[model samples]
Each structure stands twice: as C-alpha cells, then as structure tokens.
Target chain A: MKSRFKTGIVAAVAAAGLLLSGCGPAATGAGGETLTFMFRGGADEKAAYTKAIGEFEKANDVKVNMIVTTPDDYSTKLKAAIAGKKVPDVFYVDPGSVQAYVKTGVVKNISEFVEGSDSIDLDNIWQYGVDSYRFDGKLMGQGDIYALPKDVGPFSFGYNKTMFDEAGIPLPSADTPYTFDEFVDVAKKLTKDTNADGKLDQWGTGLNVQWNLQPFVWSNGADWLNQDRSKVTVDTPEFAESLQWFADLQNVAKVTPSVGEAQTLDTYQRWMQGQIGFFPVGPWDVSTYEKLPFEWDLIPYPAGSTGKSATWTGTLGIAVSNSSKAPEKAVELAKFLSANETAQQSLVDAGVQIPNLIDMSDQWVKDSTTKPANKQEFLDIVKDYGRGLPANSTYSAEWYDELFKNIQPVLDGKKTAAQYLKEAQPKMQKYLDQANQAAGIG
Target chain B: MSTITRRSTLHRKEQRVALIFVALPVIGFAVFTIFPLLFSVYASFTEWNGISAPVFTGLANFQAMMVDPYFWQAMWNTLFLMIGIPIGLSLSLLLALALNRKMRGTTFFRTVYYVPVISSIAAVAILWQWAFNGDFGLINQALAMIGIDGPNWLANTATVKPAIIIMSVWKGMGYSMLLYLAALQSVPRHLYEAASLDGAGVLQQFRNVTLPMLRPVTFFLVVTSIIGGSQIFIEINIMTPGGGPEFASASIVWYIWQKAFNYLQMGYATSMSLVLGLIVFAVTAIQFRLNRRNQFSID
Candidate 1:
C-alpha cells in the first residue's frame, strides 16, 4: 500500500510537471539559429512571405518562423507579445506606430547595420522611405534610421473602363488633372438606376474618409497640422471646404452609397463587382482585382483648388526587435526581406506591393501587362506629390484618429463640415497636446 | 497507540491525500486568477502604459474617471444593457413553462433553443449583424413586407442598443430557460394538487406555487446575468467597430479594452475594470440582501 501510494504521487507529480511545461516559454527551433517574423495580412500576403522566407532559409541555413495575423489584431497581438517578453525577432512596423513602439525601446536602431552593410544602397532607395524611419533620438523623421521600407503604398483611384465605355465617357488621362467640380460632375454622370426601382443600383464612387479623403484635403492646400507640427490647422476654410465637398458626394449629391447601403455591400465589394465608378486603389489590390470581369485602370487623384493632386503614402517597414536573441541574424533577415532586389522583385511579381527600390519601381509598373493601363500614374504620384500622413510628430496619430472619428458625423449629414470641425478641432488639439506631453516633445 | 489515536491518524492521512489531489487546482487558481486579480488591483493605482515601468499615481486614474465623458457613457450603456436581463428572464420563464409540457418534439425543441448558447460569439455576432443590416437584411425585408419602414438597426444610434439587447436576449434566453425547466421539474406535484384543492386556477397556482418555488433560481439567474451583461465585449467588438455609429453601443468592458490595447493605457484600463468589478460586487450584494428575506432553503 505504501509503495502504491508513492507511485500514485509520482504519477501526479509527472502530470503536473507536464502541464506546467506547456505554460512555459516557447522552445527554440531544432537548428542552431531561429528567427521569428511577425507580419499582418491575409493569405496571399502570408504565401508571399512564406516563399520569400523559404528562400532566405535555404540560403542562410537558418530557420525562419513566420507569424501571420490579421491587420486589425496585429497591434494587439504585438503589444501582448512585447508585454509577455516574447517579442518576435523581427516585425512589420508602420509609420503611425513607429514613435509609440520606439518609446518602448523594442524597435532596434538599424543604422549601424545599414551603414556597415555593403549590399544595400541607401541612395538608390527613396529618401522619403528612409526618412520616415529616422528619429533624432527624441523626434521621429529626422536622425538615425530604425527600419527599412518593405514597400510604399501610394493612394490613387482605380476606375472601371467598362463603366466608362458603357456610359460613353472617355477614360481619364494619366497626366490630366480633374478639378473638384469636374470630378463631382463626372461622378453624377456615372451614377445610375438600371432597374428603375426608385433606388440607384450603381454608385459613382465611395469615400472612406480615413484612407481616400487625404488626397482631397491635401490637394486643396489644407492640412491637419501647422508648419512645425505644433498645432491643429484643420478648422481652416480650405479644410472645411474639402471635407464638405467629400461629404456632399454621399449626402447631398447622393452619388456614393449611404453608410447603411454601404454596410450591405462594402465599397470594396461594390468596386470588385463593377458597380462603383471610382474606388481608391493601392498596389496591394492589383492581385485581388486581377480576377475581376471589368477592365479597371489607375488614375491620379482629382486636383482640388491648388490644382495639384497630393496623396498620402503608406509604407510598411521591416524592424528588428531589441529582445531578439540573435540580433545579427535578425538584421540579416530584415535586410533580406526589405532591401534584397530578388525579394523585392518577388513581391512585385506577386503584385503584393510596389518595389521600394527607386530604380526597380519603373520596371515593376512596366512589367505588369495585365489591367491598370495607367499603372505609371502610381509611380508619378509617388514621385511628384506623395506625402506621408501628418505623422512626423509623435502626437500626429492621436490627432489624425480624432479627426477621422469626428468627421464621420459630417459624412453622415448629421453635421456640416464647418460645424463638425469647429466642435472637433479643440478635441484634436487636446489629444495632440496630451500625446506631445507624454512623448516629452514641445 | 490508543483506538482514538489510530482513528485520528487515519483521518489526518485521508485529509492529506485529499489535499494532494486538490493541490494542482489550488496552485493554478492562485497563480492564474488570484495573483492577476491582486496585481490588477495594484496596477490601478499606477500610471503604466503596459510597455514602460509603472509609476505610482495614487487616485489620478479614479479622478480622471469622474470627468471622462466616455467612461460615464460606457457605464450608462452597461446599465442600459442590463435592462434586457429582466425582460430576458420573463421570456425564458414563459419558454420554460411552454416547453415543460409533455410534447412530442420536446427534445428537438430544447436542442434548437439551446444551440445559440453553444454557438461561438464571433459566429453569432456576424449572423446577427447580417440579420440587423438595414438595406438587405432579412429583418428589414420582413418588416417592409408588412408595410412598415424598418430603421437601420445597427447604424442608427437610437436603434443600435436595442438591436444589441435583442440579440443578447435571443442568444442567452435558452440557458435561463433550461435552468427554469430544471427548477420546475423539481417542484412537488403535491403542492400543485393542494393549491388546486383550494380552488386555485392555473395562473393562481403559478403565482402562488411556481413563482415562490423558483425564487432561488430566479435570484441566481438575475445575479449571474447582470454580471455577464456588464462585461459584454465580443458582441460589441465584432458587430460595431469603434463602438458603433456615435459610441452608442460601447460598453464598460469595450471601453476598458480600447483604453488598454488601443491606447496602451494599461493602468487606466485596470482602474476602470476595478471600478466595474466593485459595481458588480455591490449589485450582487444588494441582490443577495433582497433575496435573503425570502429565505428559501431546500432543507
């Protein structure tokens, strides 16, 4: 009986030990060196990364583990990982999140790596892409580079050629700029009610204020921040005017679908189904739209009062984590992922992103023989007029998010542009001030 | 050793063995639940953003809560959501009484009713979102057929909360009904016969015997549902991105999540959570006190 009891205790202890082991930190790979890379996107993005990582692994003889998460859940998961002290070796960083992440000291400064490397040519890469990751130890967009740009996403419109042809409207030229009034007139002409059911089945365009409204706001020579990024300037007449024009597309002009109508079939789906006349397109949408039955092509954003088509440029950068066990290996992986010509070309071929290399972007645009006859327009916008979101300051995201949140009422026709901005500017300024205080930035 | 001593030794041995059997769970409860609970309570007093080291901030977070309109709005929304509990409980009782009859397809009906309880919240939220959609949803179409114009259920601020409440009741009613059905089955038939002998009708019997007997179950459901309703997160998160059309459907837990995860204000989030926990405790205590007077003991 004593022996049996002892055996039972031993079994229980073993079971408890096994259960506790599962809760412990994750094990390293079987090989000597292992690097974990976390990124955000769906299946196609995952597939592209998998292929690239597979090539990297074969070449270096080091195992690379890829963690893919949806864009919505990426920040939450990344933060949780950091808090748990299990930060990935490398991760995708966005400009809006750079300052916040940098304050935590998790993002490694890749300046030394870049400077020491013989492979990557800093001059050949876009200056804006590199400048976005630079921080002067205190302020962002200045000093040493912390990350390398994986790709640059320039905002433009992808219009359906079939819709234009069916309506007997001529296709827009790559260089020709449409004024605000002309753009609205074209939108009005494109909207139709095919079945005469008293409800329009087709929309001229769709406006997602967060993504597509920047071009309009910027083109009108209005901005959310002042020259030195010290104050909120969105309450100006120019800003209100642009916003009102965008809102009128949906509310007054009734060319775009209402919020309720859009919920049924989102703007993206409507664009895919050839129901929308114009929708914002990024290089990432090229692969998704390849299967579309309609012929679609890119066009520069319509010019506002300034007669200059200014659009926001979004870039995803490859960053090394400070918690990485093998920082050297991780840097190599980051370099391979971001700066390697072959890897960039592979991404370009997949139509996942435009090439980050200045020289290769032209090749990328010309190489795509499919739809988007005006693919060069994307390059033109990026080269001539593309600007990043007003995220040069640490407090930029807080103010930008506040603006996006408050501007919805204006779009819904619950409030006019002037009225909404008047109410929201103070709130935006408050958030900006708080964020600046937190970041110790004057 | 004396016989008493031997008996005491055996008893002590038995106790030790039981303790050994429960040791794993006790350790788990301590490490995972109790420690986190205590840590969060302490964290509420700090000014940590999850990444940086926490700085002691005393009552600043609580003070901020006083002036924070969003926090107050979330609290009001949470309380408003609990309005569904009483309505849900009454509906569940009715369902229980109906389903308690000796029907042919009772098992099938019971399974059908309970299915939503087992369904994942994400799946249910998506399903209900589609059903509540304004333009192409089935609910609006059904209403349209009756010559009534249905409002945008999820989009309109006025209708969003009611839509959430309706979905919550539908999803949760079955579990409450099952509890009621069990309680009803346990009620002695002799008591009903006695009531009938006194010339009581079905409704009178229900009021006099059924309701009185099910008081304990009702108390349990009420307390649990209130606590559950206050912590509503997934449904709101999935159905309404950024707390819906004007923060109309934002609940306390959703607000806490945004403060913690979205803004990285971990300390503020924990403070709000602590406040929510205290509120739940006070509400539960009051419920217990109210029910204490009834003194329904099975023994």
Candidate 2:
C-alpha cells in the first residue's frame, strides 16, 4: 500500500510538470502581441491618457499595457527595465534625455515611419517640437526624428487677480512687459500682512531657481553656454548680475518668503492658498488650479537687460523603444498619442497640455471652459521667444544639477554670485567638454 | 549484516530527498544574489554606462574616489547618522525595562511603540517633514510656546543631520525595544532576587543583574543598528532631495544611487559600492572579534 501511494505521488508530480511545460509558451505567445506604453504624470494627466488609450485599444483591437510612474521614479524605473531587457514598447521621452537615450541606441528613429504615414501631418505640428527630437547622427535638433512632442510647456507667470484687487494694484497687460526693477516694485506692493500680525502672511512672488530662473538669465542677455555650445558663458558679469537680482528678491528685498519660510509651505501651496501674488505657472497646472478660491491669469515674464521676455519651454515626447517586438505598432501608437488631433484635443480640453499642433493652438486657447483669462500668452511665448534649456547634450544633466546644487549657498546669501559662478564655471565646463566628446560633438 | 544494509539504503534515500528539497532555493540564491555580487565586483574595475559596453579601466574609478570631495562628504554624513544608534539603543532599553514589569496595559504600550516600525517609510518621512518645517511645524510651535525660537530643522545645513538623526531614533527604537523585551523575559529571576537580598536598590539591581544578563542582546542590537544606520537613503531622499541645502544630509548610499542612476556612471557607482561593502564588513568583523574576546554567553 505504501509502494502504491509513492507511485501515485510520482505520477501526479510528472503530470503537473508536463502541464506547466505546456502553459509557458502558450502564455507568452498570446501576450507577446500586446504593446506596452509607459508614462509619467500626476492624476489628471493619467486620467486623460487612460481615456485616450482606451479609445486606441478599442479602435485597433490591440491590447496595450499602460504603466504610470511618478516623475521622480520614472527615469530610475525605465533604466532598470532597459537593463533587465524588458524595455517597454513606447515610453515618454524628454528633451533633456533625448541625446543620452539616442546615443545609447535605446530610442528608435521613427523618421521612416513618419515619412511613410499619410495620417500624420508634420506640417501642422510646431517645428520647434519636431526639432527637439531630431538628431543628425551626432548632433541633436538636425537629424532623424526619434520622437514626437506630446505637449509644449511654456513657462509664464500666473498672477492672482483677487490678490491684486485686494492690494489695489492693477493687473499687468500681457503685451506690455515690466522691467525687472518695475516688476520688483509691483511685487513689494503686493506683499502684505493682512491680519496686522507681526509676521507677514502674504508674499509678493516666488521663484523656482531650477525652473523659472532660466527666463531671467536669458532675458538679461546672458546664456549658460555660448552660441556654439562649446564654452560655458555663465561666468559673464551679466549672468551674475541677473542671478543676484533674482536671489535678492528673497534675501535682500524681503518680499518673497525666506528659504526657511518657503520650506514650511512651498510657493505652489502658498499660491494655491491665495497667499502668493505671483508664481510661475505651466500649462500642466491649469487643471489643478481651476478650483482655486482666487482668480488667476497668465502674463509674460518680466523683461530684463535684453528688453525682451525670454521664457523657457519644455517638451515631452513619445518615442518607440529599440527593443520593441512590435515596432510598427508602437510607432502607430506614438503618432496616435502625439500627432492625432482628436487625442491631442482631449489633453488640451483637460487643461493638462498646450496644443503641439500648429494652428490648433487657437482651439486650446479658445476653450472658454478653462480658467486663466490670458491663454493666448502661452502661444505667444512659444511662437516668439520659447527656448530650450542649455544642457541639451548627452551626459549633461549631472553637470546642470551640480550648478544648481552648488548655487544654493549663493541664493542663501552665504556666497556672492560672482564668487560662486567663478568657482562653478570650470567644473561645469569640464562636464560639458566630456559630454561633447562622448556624443562626438565639437 | 542484512540489518546494516537496510539502514544504509534508508540513509541514502533520505539524503536524496534532502538534496531535491534544497536544490530550488540554492539555485535561486546563485541566480539572484551570488551572480549579481560577482558581476558588480567585475564591473567595478571597468568603465561602463548602463547602456554601452564596459571598457577596461583598471583602478581609474578607485583613483577618482581618492580626490572626490563629495564621496568624502557622503562618508562623513553616514558617520554622523550613526551617532543616533547609541542614543536610540539606550532609550529603547529604558523603555523595555519599564515595560517588562508585570503591569497593566504593558501589551498596549508595546503595540503603540511598535507601530512606527511597521508603518511605511514614505508615509513616515512625509509626517516627519511636516513636523520639521521651520515656520509652522509642531516642533517650532512647541518651542515658541516656551519662548524659544526653533531653527529651520530641515533647510539649515547646521541642523539637518540632527533632525534626520532624531527621526531615525524615533522610527527605529521600537525594534530594539522588542528585542530587549525578549531578552529581559529570559533573564533568570533568581539573579535579581539575590541582588535584592544583598540589600541592593532597584537601580543597583538593574545595573548588576539586568544589564549584565542583557549584554548579548545589547551587543547584537549595537552591531545591527550600526550596519543599518550607516546605509540610510530613503529618509534623506524624501526629506532633502539633492542633498538638502548644500549636500548636508547626503549619505554614502544616496551618493552611490545618484551616480549609478542620475549620472549613469555604473562603473564608478559599483566601485563605491564595493568600498562601502568592505567598510561594513570590516566594522562587523571587529565587532564580532570584540564580542568573542569578551566571551558573553549568547545562548
């Protein structure tokens, strides 16, 4: 009886092993045909993408595995996935990451796909958006297009109209720009202590040095790199002066919150709570800020020494991965996400993104359902003065981050701007030179 | 002779069954742990980004480490974080001693203390970030009530490390307390009774009886906490990203992660990892040696 029981157990185990062997290939074969799409965004952005992706899946009769990650964890997770040889079929690509990703041969050049597709209207899309992903073998912005822009994020100022009214200050016109000095004066007036407390409860303006500070640096007629991108230009006196002026808004002018005060409630939170007069607003925040108790409107950044309001524009693009099994289908999905007017309109209506398609931006601006009275200002900046960041080369993010990291001491009034820039220039130049060499650029 | 043959056959069958049972896990260890360790050691000697082929560059990464000020700063920050371990261990021990007595609601107190250990690190970090805020934080508000101004706990370079240490101690004390509680339960009751009969006070009895009896548990806690404290990453990452006001709170593991992922300097990151691993191994070895020399009864 014991021998019979042992035989029964062995037979049962063999049958189970045979069943598992049969299941493995069948499972993979069925799922291998489905495409995977990965992106990074907050809740509203996710909801918009979910609606669009659902439409695409239903129309194409193809399954898509959507993966959403936070902006902080996206790069780490993507790199790990690539290293593990489980690269997603399509993924979000940023302008800063384009060169590095392309150099590593992870991103596919979809120019052939773009050229052949009759459905995609390249002429309708903004040229700057197209140029952002173009790589000419060695240099970016000139060659084959690796991705298509999902949205154009033009950085502009969003001012609380309710605060302006309460402060008895008239709203600034979108076309008429304020000089840096005049802007600071307006900010000083807007700052107040409403309840007559010893502490000031409201701030004039807030500046995120990492993001919004670029406009001031550019409008001051100072550049991070020279025209050719060969040498660091941040050591110039103009750059130092511009940076000092912006830093002084908090440290010297005493209008904005101190670094310590800002830590308690970030400028964004303060702005949402109707405590900040002005803050840099991107199109992505339109959906989030719609429910604010105060009225807000967009305006151009204040002009500086250059006599022009030069703003920084960022782009998020969709690209097919090189390791994708379904490259053709992935490119189709990328085009659907980025180029198709129907899909783009959904995102624009949701107030999460500005139109990437030219002429179609009027539709985005005319969407009366959205808040922000001066939506036209976003398009004006993008069309006239929007510029990408200076750190566009491969392996340059570290160097760019280093500049900001080391400059915190200067912003805190511990070091002079001139002194910090002089010390940081050589290190930044070294990184730029190495990155140029790595990317085979001069 | 026939009985001996039967016994040998049964022993061989038992051995075969044991091998079959252990094979799966041994294979998993080799694939997941051993293979990566060996590969990382090899990669440490080469120059490779995650995407490209690694180039042979002997000692270059190690040479770079010698002059890297950031690496040294990270090490210093890691050491600074370890200062909390001793303070944490002592506090936990006191709590364990108080709770170990047969008192009402001891289990309730134990559960309350253990809650933070089981809570998610991200959640705990967000809670602590709010508490450490300079202007409106609970800590600063409390300080203000007593006519003392609180420094910007997280934003100031001078106070950031201390703030991190305080949070670390609060979050980790529960684990140590439980361990000490277990050790206290096993302590022979007669040892304390004898000390009492000798006219010793409660404090003297604790020092003479409880502490010496709990030495092994203390030693274990010390060694493990040091190893754990020196590798703090999540707290710094969440509270003070980009090293928090001039890289004041960046630990060695945080630096390693930045190099590997942010900079794509995989080879350099691996080299740093190997060095960190060696440092941990050396410290643990010294602790074991000291423990052996003292000859504390672990069992």
Candidate 3:
C-alpha cells in the first residue's frame, strides 16, 4: 500500500510539471529571470521575436517570452488586460492610441529610466518620434526613452509598372508628379473593357472607401474636425470639393470601381493581384508588394491645390503597463527594445520599416530594396514635409468614426459632398463639445 | 437515545448540509451576475470614462437618446427583424410537418437539416456574405444565368436590410423547425385519424387537429423568437459592419457597442441598453397576451 501511494505522488508531480512548463511559466535561465514583450504583428512575426529573445537571453542571462497580437484588436485587449490588473511588462503603443492609454494611468511614465542612461542614446531619436510619446513635456516613457519609433508607415499613391508600360505613359518623375487633372485623365484612359462585355475589365484606381481617406482631405489643407479638434469640419468648401472629386472618380470620371464591384475583393487584395492601379498606401505596401507577383512602383501623391504634397504619419512606440509587477525591469526591457542599435537593425533586416531614430533611418533608406520603386522618396517626404492629425486625448476615435460614417454616403453618391458636410458638422460638434467638456479643455 | 430527539437532530443536520451546498453557487451568482447588472443600472445615470470617477447626470442620457437619430434608426432596424420572426416560425412549422413522416432516409435528412442549428451564426453569416457578393457571388451568378440582373446585395442601402433578413431566416430556420418537429411527434396519431374520419380534407384536418395540438409549442417559439430577434447583434456586427452600406442595417446592440467602446460614451450606452431591455420586455408581454387570446387549444 505504501509503494502504491509513493507511485501516485510521483505521477501527480510529473503531471503538474508538464502542465506548468507547457504554457503557464516559461523556462527560466540561470538567473531565473523572465521578461514579457507584447508586440502587434503575430503569426510569422513571433519567429523573429523568438530569435531576438534568444540573443537577448544569451547576452544577459534572462529569458524573454513574447506575445504578439494583430493590430486590429490589440488596443481593446491591452485596455482590458490593464483593467484586470494583469498588464504585460512591455507593449507597442501607436500614436493614435497613445493619448488614450496615457489618460488611463495604466501606462507608466518612463522619464527617470532615461535621464542619464548611456545604454541607450536619445539624441539620435527624431523630434516627432519623441513628441509622439511626450505627455505634458515629461516623457511618459520614464526618464529613459520609453519608445523608439522603429518605423514610419508614410502614405503615398502606388501604380502597377506593367499597367503603365501597357498604357505607353512615361513613368512619373520627381519633377512632374501627375497634375490633378492629368491624374484624372490617366485614370480614365487606363480604365477600359477589354472583352466585348459592357462591364469594365480594369479599374484605374481604388477609392478604398474606408477609414483611411483622411489624408486626401488633409492634402487639400482641410480636415474632418476643426483646428482645436473641437468641431466637425466636413462641411467646408475644401472638404466638399474633395468629396466631389472622390465620388466623381467613380460616377463622373468612371475611373474607379463602384463599391459593389470593389466588394469582389478588398482593395489591397485587388491591387496585389494586379487588377487595379494607383492605390494610396503606406511604405508597408512596398514590403507587402515585394511578396506579390506584380511589379509596382510608388509616386508621391500629386500636389494638392495648395501646392504642397501631403502624407499621413503613423508612429509605433513602446509603453510600460502600470500594473507590471517589476516596473523598473519592464522599463529596462522597453528601453532596450526601443533604442538599442542592434535591436533596431534586427527589426529592419526582417523588414525595411523606418526606424524612429533619425540616424538609423539613413541606413534603412540606403538599404531599401524598393528601388526604381523608390521607398526612400516617401520616407524623405515624411522626414521633411509630413504632419499628423492633432491627437486629442478625448475624442480621437469618435471623431474618426463620425468622419467615416458621414462621408460614406458621399462616397456612394447618395448625397453631394456639400450636403454631407453640412449635415455632418453640427452632429460632430455635439460629440466634440461633450468630449472637450469631459477633458476640461474649454 | 429518545426517538423524538434523534429525529429532530437528523432533520437539522440535513438542513445544514443543504445550506452549505447552496452557499457557494448563491455567492457566485451574486458576484458575477446580479452585482454587475445592478452596477450597470447605476452607471447608466452617471458619466464615467472607464478610468475616472463617475459624476451624476440625472436623466441627461435618456434625454439625449430621445433625440439621437441613430438611436431611432437602430430601433427601426431591430423592429424589422422582430417582424421577420413570425414569417420564420410559420415556414419552420411547414417544414417540420413535411419532415414528420415515415420515409426512407428520414433520420439522415433530419440530421442534415439540423446541421446549421449547431454551426455558429458568424460562420453562417460569412458564408451568406460570399453568397451575396455582387460580382462573383453565387446568387448573382444564378440570377445572371436566369437573365435577371441582381441588385448589389450588401452595398446597396435598399437591399442590405432585406439581404440580412433573408440570411437570418436561413441561419435560424433549422432550430425552430426542430422544436416544431418535436412538438409534432408528441401529437397522437389517433387524433389525425379521427379528424379524417369526420369528413375533413388534408387542409381541414391540419387546421382542426394539428394546429390545435401544437399551440403550446407555438407559444414557446413565438415568445422565444421575439426575445431573440429583439437582441439581434451578431449578424449586423459580422456581415453589415458600418451599419449596413448607409445606416440601413444598424441594430440596437451594435449601436450600444459603438457608443460604449468606439465612442467611449459608457453612460449613454448603458441608458440605451436599459431602454432596449424595457422595449423587449413590453413587446414580450404584449405577445404573451395576444397568444393567449388566439390560442387554438383554448378555443
């Protein structure tokens, strides 16, 4: 009986060990240290991160467990994790969401961690990158630089080189980016029915009737909300004219596919398959297009009537969760991940994303494989000329949602652009007013 | 021991054990369900932005909800689905009658029809979306073959709500049919035979006999369908995101989700949810009253 009892205890111990080691607790190194890293890109991304952690572990006698999430639902999940007091040690914070996360007190301020650290250099970081994470001028990233902008997704218009060749148009040059009228004319000529069928076989461009069209409005020196981010500006003459031009691409010019036809596949999927030309996208598309069979090239968006080229800016940064058990250790990991030259190079080699460090971006620009396609041209624009929407802490997401909903009718040709703007602004003003009041920003 | 004392002691011990067993579950319910519901009710009257302290706002939320056009649009969309519940029930009843027979492969057919009942609504909605796609969708292809041009199923505002209603019926038909099938089985075969001998035709026999027999099941299905339809959130979320092409397909639950998570109007969202719950409660009460008056079994 004693022998049987001993055997049972041994079996139970073995079972517990298997369960605990599998998912609950990561294997410990010699120092028995574990660091958690949360990032946006999951799937194949975890492999690169796992390798990085292996290098970090061998160098520092610390084990790192990385949890990667898709960008779409990560913010909502991160917020929930913080609310439940189970925040990850380190996570990515996009500029769009940084304001909201900062207000919640769930993310730690990292000013002290960076005050005099020689381990990471802050001088090499870009001003915009630094400012993206700055709250009340006390770098929210602890005294140490919390986040290093590893890459910028700078928006531009792309076209299929094969389609340009077939159409017999000279490739767009820096001196003469297609004029607005010329751009429309080119799209019209490119859009045609090859088969005797009445339906057009090729679309010249994709409007991408989604949340990302704000750049077009901004390019015209107009925006969805007013300067203070307090009221909707959709009804302005510039916004209305922009909408008309957007809709006319489908209804009047017949250069773009209607929403119905566009639904056959998403605009990106269609562009990747070489069915459409001239889509507005970020530098990430260069990486995306590298995997596609089609040969595509990028062009700076045509100068708006204001005679200035415009692009949208999205910055990704590092943030420490307030509920972290070891805030100091977490800040260290965040600093290493954000500002380390070796770490940044490792991320760049995996993909040619723009690093937040201004000095590192020069190397990235030189190393870019998107040549003849010229990925550097877009990065140059972001460095020299680009500006982002004002990131208001109170109603950024709501304002964006409202702008999209109100413009959808205009895109579909159900309402004229002027009519849509007129109807949308007052309603938007109500939301902005409430948000401003809540934020104490009267 | 004295007999009376022993009996009393045993009774007390049994009661103590019962209370001990019930204690854990009662506490669990109070902590998880009852407390949250009460907290939400309190939250509906205040302004709280997830992290901050909530301030009292009285009936401000309700007052605003009364004027919000989107709130009314969502209510209208919900009512559209609520109206479809009866159409779905009657069709299921017909299908259940046809299937309730001694035919070859009857069990196989029954299982096949019951397949969708087990599959998730999201998976079914996605399938319907592909089927409804305008250019390459199977429905459009079929219509093209028949020389009839189909309208854009999801993109066109006029057709989106109808498309959703049709998809909802397709997704929901199997479960109600199974319920009616079970109810049909419980009716005695002798009653049908008696009705037939009394010189009634097939339709007459069904009207006089089967209809009356299935009243209880009908009442169950109608009440449940009303409750379910009034809370339709998933189909709108998955298929008709952005509230259908032009706000034509927005439902109350989807609007509540937008207000709370997207807009960060937590107090307003709570008030909207409470109002929706009250609307459902009133509708169900009215439905129960109408069902009682029209019940075939009572007549």
Q: Which candidate is the best by DockQ?
A: 2
How large is the interface RMSD of each prediction? Answer: 3.3, 4.9, 7.6
List model 3 lDDT by residue over B1-299, tens digit each. Answer: 69999898767765655554455467657766899889888889998665555678999989998998899989998888676778788888888988898778877877887788889888888898888888777899999999988877988878888888888887778888998899999988888788788888999988888888888888888888888888888888878878876688899999998787666577888889988888888988997898879865422
Native contacts conserved, per model: 0.26, 0.48, 0.28
Worst window of 10 by summed lDDT in candidate 2 chain B: B16-25
Model 1 - which docking category?
acceptable
- The 10 consecutive residues of candidate 2 chain A with the worst lDDT sum are A22-31
Error of 2 at A60 (Å): 3.4
lDDT of 3 at B98: 82
Q: Judged by lDDT relative to the true structure, which candidate is superior, 2 or 3?
A: 2
Candidate 3 lDDT at B144 equals 96
For all the predictions, what are the DockQ values? 0.44, 0.49, 0.24
TM-score of chain B of each: 0.93, 0.93, 0.94
Q: Please list the residue runs of candidate 3 whose C-alpha ends up more than 4 Å from where it truly belongs after superposition.
A: A1-39, A54-67, A137-151, A196-198, A264-266, A340-352, A356-360, A368-372, A389-394, B292-299
Off by over 4 Å in 1: A1-26, A29-31, A262-265, A341-346, A391-396, B1-23, B297-299
Answer with 2 or 3, whichever has the higher DockQ: 2
